[model samples]
Target: MINETELIEQLKRGDDTAFRTIVEQWQDMVYNTILGIVQNETEAEDLAQDVFIKVFEKIGTFKGDSKFSTWLYRIATTTALDHLRSRKRKKRSGFLQSLSGSGGEEKEQIPDFHHPGVSLDNKERAAVLFKAIDELPDNQKAAYTLHKLEGLSYRDVSEVLNTSVSAVESLMSRANQNLRKQLEEYYNKHYR
Candidate 1:
């Protein structure tokens, strides 16, 4: 296996094999990052492909300031957020069209996203936690997803978010509170 430095050097030289190797090595990481944010399997898959395309196209701009995985993860997170924003814009447009009596595209259903890395016995519990995560504000959700779901360190998440670690900590604290509230409400509503 080629070392990452050598592989990146080959990629910068436009070597197809090196590009393929990078894709194969990093695809799951990219996919899971997008999946954690977007919470839709099909959209995550599509956006993951888009992330790699951007990585390939921008390979020459890599400065080696951070690890390749860090750079790649930043791209994946940004791509996923972009996808979510575009979908929201479309949904608003579709709603406006319907208000004007013009039939619009049907709303897409978001499934209960199951992380492939989650243990089989924990799937249902993880699903509930993810549903609460989906309710978090964008910043809090991104922080939590990167730190808790993706297992990135707080410093790494701060770097990806372009924020201080303290800010990441605050976001995580709020996220934890919100998640607890949501879970409590859910349990009270269903289990009462």
Candidate 2:
């Protein structure tokens, strides 16, 4: 296998085949990153494509300071985040979701349709839970999603969030406390 530096060199030289190679190499990781953010496979696919288009357009500026994969993941994360923010703006502006979500912080009973997980049932509660989560402050939701849902380590989460690791920890702590209170209220209302 050629080293990543060689791949970057080939890509910099403007070889279309090298670009295809980069796509084939990174698509799964790219797709997974977007899925973790949007929780929608269809949207994830489009976002991943957008990331690649960005990578192609900006490859010449890739400074070579970071590993290519790391650089790519950063691009993926930013693209996914931009897409998420756009969706949030749309949602709040009265766009009805075609597919439903539980909207709470508690893991939904059924496995994520796009991810493998322990099987469970009765996702309506999760939808209600998500509604509560959606009501949270933006920082809290972002901390919870990056730490809990994405399972990124504190350092990684900090890097993605552009905060110190201790700050990430504090944010996650507050997020958990807020989610617990919200979920408890949710449980009493529906499960009591």
Candidate 3:
């Protein structure tokens, strides 16, 4: 198999095979990262696919300033956030059509993720955690997901999120505090 630099060079020259190579190499990371954002099997799949599509479409614009994975993830995060915003806009529009006392209810159901490790039952809990993540501000959500979920170093996360290392740390700290508060509420409601 060709190495990343050769693959990228081919991709820059508009080679479809090279694009596929990049996708095959990094699709798992893209999927997992998108899953962390969208949290639905189908939506995550579509978003992951969409990231590759965008990469292929825009490969010429890539100037090789960073690792390919980092660039791909930046695209994935922006796409997922765009998806979230569109969904929210749709919900808002639907709410406007609802009768009085019906405007406050949301149709989206955030699942529960009580387990962080590998447990079959933890899928539901993981879903819950993802929902809480979606609720966070973009910076906090990006920092938390990049560092905690994606297992990137703080420096890597800062690069991905386009912030300083210190800013990333603070974002993560606030994210953790916010997550703790949200998870505690969930626990109290369900297990207490």
Candidate 4:
């Protein structure tokens, strides 16, 4: 295995092979981080590619103040959140257009999303869980996704989010409470 320092140095020097190696080493991690946030395979895949492209373009800005993975996670999280915001904006605009009768487009229906990381037996439950996760505030959602779905430690999540560990802990606590409320509502409606 190439030393991470050497690989990064080569990447900084614009070595194509080093860039390829870095992508190969971190692609799955990047993809999974994005997938957990976006909760859609195609968008996650596309966002993962965008993350790498940003990495290549912005590698010079990496000051080595934090672990490379921390920086990469920050990039992934930001990119995914930006895409979500853009989607929300487009949806809102579409809604307004329909209200004004300028848009002949029918209402768009998002299908139930299933994360591939979920097992077959738990797919339905996982889908419900992800929907609740989607309702969390952005900070809580990012903290929860990093710490729970991506298996990152609270401290690691804090670094990626550029916040204190205590903030991450608080976010996780709020996220859990919100998710419980959302899930309970879902179950009450369907199973009660």
- Top candidate on lDDT is 4
Q: What lDDT is reached at residue 33 by model 1?
A: 83
lDDT per residue as tens, model 1, 55-137: 88999999998889989988988888877778889889889997888996576666787888899999998999998998888
**16-128 per-residue lDDT for model 3 (tens digits):** 88887788889888887777776666887999988998898898898889888889889988888889889889877777756455565556555553333447776776766
lDDT, residue 54, model 3: 89
lDDT of 4: 0.92
Sort by lDDT, best first: what order? Answer: 4, 1, 3, 2
lDDT of 3 at 89: 92
Order by TM-score, highest first: 4, 1, 3, 2
Q: Each prediction's TM-score against the native?
A: 0.90, 0.70, 0.87, 0.97
Mind giving the per-residue lDDT tens digits that candidate 2 earns over 1-192? 877888888888988988999999999878876665566778889999999999988999998875676677678777877887887786654423323443543433433343432234645555555555555665566656556655768887766666789998888788778878988887787784
Q: Candidate 4 versus the native: TM-score?
A: 0.97
lDDT of 4 at 79: 96
What candidate 3 gets wrong by more than 4 Å, as runs, is: 100-117
**Which number leads on TM-score?**
4
Measured over all alpha carbons after superposition, the RMSD of each candidate to the real structure, in angstroms, is 2.0, 6.8, 2.8, 1.1
For candidate 2, the lDDT comes to 0.72
